[model samples]
Target: MDRVPQVEFNPMAGLRPAGASFTVFAELREQYDWFRSTVGQGFWVLTRYERILEALNDPERFSSSAITVLDPEPAYRWIPEMLDPPEHTAWRRLLRPHFTPASAAAMEERIREHCRELVDGLAGKGGCDFVADFATRFPTVVFLEMMGLPTERLATFLEWEDTILHRPYEPGRATGRRKALAAVVGCFRELIADRRAEPRDDLVSAALAWRMDGEPVAEDDLLSLCLLLFLAGLDTVTAQLAYMFWHLAGHPADRDRLASDPAAVPTAVEEFLRAHAITVTGRKVTRDGEFHGCPMKAGDMVLLPLNSATRDPAAFPEPERVDLGRHPNRHLAFGAGPHRCLGAHLARLELRIAVEEWHRRIPAYEPDPDRPALEHAAQVLGLDTLPLRWPA
Candidate 1:
């Protein structure tokens, strides 16, 4: 009888990849019927593609509130996302209007203007760190503008968000993290006060006037909502842009094809998103349930590898290849069902514009071999520094 090779389960292994598409996730999914991990006596992992889809869709059985990864305290909590059922529905209704396609389209001119300015600034430089100069700044500026925040305070906002999401587990990082989070909370408090004093068309102002169950959205709820939007909108979108650019630069053929025909960007963006799903989501099972025929007990936390699902052979044919013209690409990058990303349309728009404009101006871009490629250090995945060389 043939024996299977001994393999150790290492969660940190997922984080060690210098580039996108870590294979360990797919390997674990294929080998283990259901991967399990124990942290402090009661943590579990659910890695199969099918199990993940079931958990993500069945929010009733797997409540997000039970699994508190960020800001677990009640005093400083967010609305909608953390809430389930009737309450979640109420908050979502108030928030949906701000993210409509027509509303996102209204901001296109502004988003394009920002993209042009960012690219133009790097046009003459022989090379630039794409993350710091372009990817990070682009989405940060757009999100701030959308919230009607002052551009001058962009750095402050970035610091606050990074501390909150990126350093959730490090005790040594707590001091600076707390200070930054305080600054964010303070900033939003003032913004809310001002918006309440004088309402405007911006999201923050719109949220200020929004009411639920015949009562105005409480101050804490408003701040949490704003903070969540800032973090969610900026982090994932920024990481995605960095990963897409990294892939395009490495795969020159795809970049060249995209450059020649800008119209290919929308389709290409979908494929890039599908191919590079680097984040994983967690859910706590409310009741005993069967996942891929494995019994899942109540209170079990399931880690759904979105990256694995996008590459599932059953879902996408030739799952490894990047087909620019991949049609009917239904990826879970933005997630699915009720928890689907509210910012999907806007994120797509931002990516399409970034790819189209960058390719048009730079035309021929490549990674600088001399510089060290930067890796991301958040629950979200992306490059911290992407050094690229192109003609001035």
Candidate 2:
């Protein structure tokens, strides 16, 4: 029998071409069932839908005590995600309601309003950098509003988010990220204090009042949760927005179909997510074992690109095509298993708003001819400059 092929994979290589990084995985997925890649600290690569889903499901063997692939020192110990079952379940119990479907539904109008304002900001202009003008605005602003944040100092959050996720590898970026992390936790502390004194209807206040194991949640625990929410919540949706907008701008057929039928917007959102799933997460192998013919040892890294699974041909017919009507879309864009994204309900609402509102106003937009969509990748990958022009 022939051995499976392995290629040295670099996560940074994905930054150059828009959505090119996942294509590398897709090629490997088609050529071989799995491959070995020098991703992050290096680990066996799983590109197939079943394999990636298997790892995410069997967290016992692939314990996610820490994310080894990105950042030698991760910005913060994100709750629930970085934890295993049982312990993870406890934290999730307290945090779920804040991001529940009901909660996200309640915030839909506010989110829609924010998206309209964002579109309005770029309306008269011939073109706008989707990343700068719109992509960054929706997630950060909505997050700020949802948490009862001032929304004026959104620049601070953006800076922190960029520092932590975009390029922590650059000199001084790691240090900046650590400082930014401290600042984020400090702000969360202040919010907790205020909520303790006079509880509001916001997430912070709700968290403060909540009891874990018949006692109030600990200070550090609350801070970790807040830090995670800020980092993960603001950034992932922002990146996805950039990719989705860039794709729809380029492909008029899908864009028109979605615009023509508002009801199809939700289904189109899933296809967009599947086609451009941005992140590639990691897991630490718990015990020495041969995983589906790949050699893995305890403490070894297992690079699980959610992008890989979502694009696997076995999972979706013609995985590359952005089929708006791809019903029963079981993509892992929001991840799977115990660590599935808590903000999924919020993200769906946000994505739906972005698609519906943007298409409503700028119905005939396309990628700017002069400047191409320049992309970047890390734990979260996306376009920073997606210039789009419409009929003026």
Evaluated with lDDT, which candidate comes out highest?
2
| Candidate 1 lDDT, 48-135, residue by residue in tens | 5566677778888876674432222323445566667777788878888888898889989999999999998898997899988998
Error of 2 at 351 (Å): 0.9
lDDT of 2 at 52: 90
Candidate 2 displacement at residue 334 in angstroms: 1.2
Candidate 1 weakest ten by summed lDDT: 1-10
lDDT of model 1, residue 201: 71
Give the per-residue lDDT digits (tens) of candidate 2, residues 274-299.
99998778888889878888877887
Q: How far is candidate 2 from the true structure (C-alpha RMSD, Å)?
A: 2.3
lDDT of 2 at 117: 86
On TM-score, the leading prediction is: 2
- TM-score quality measure for candidate 2: 0.94
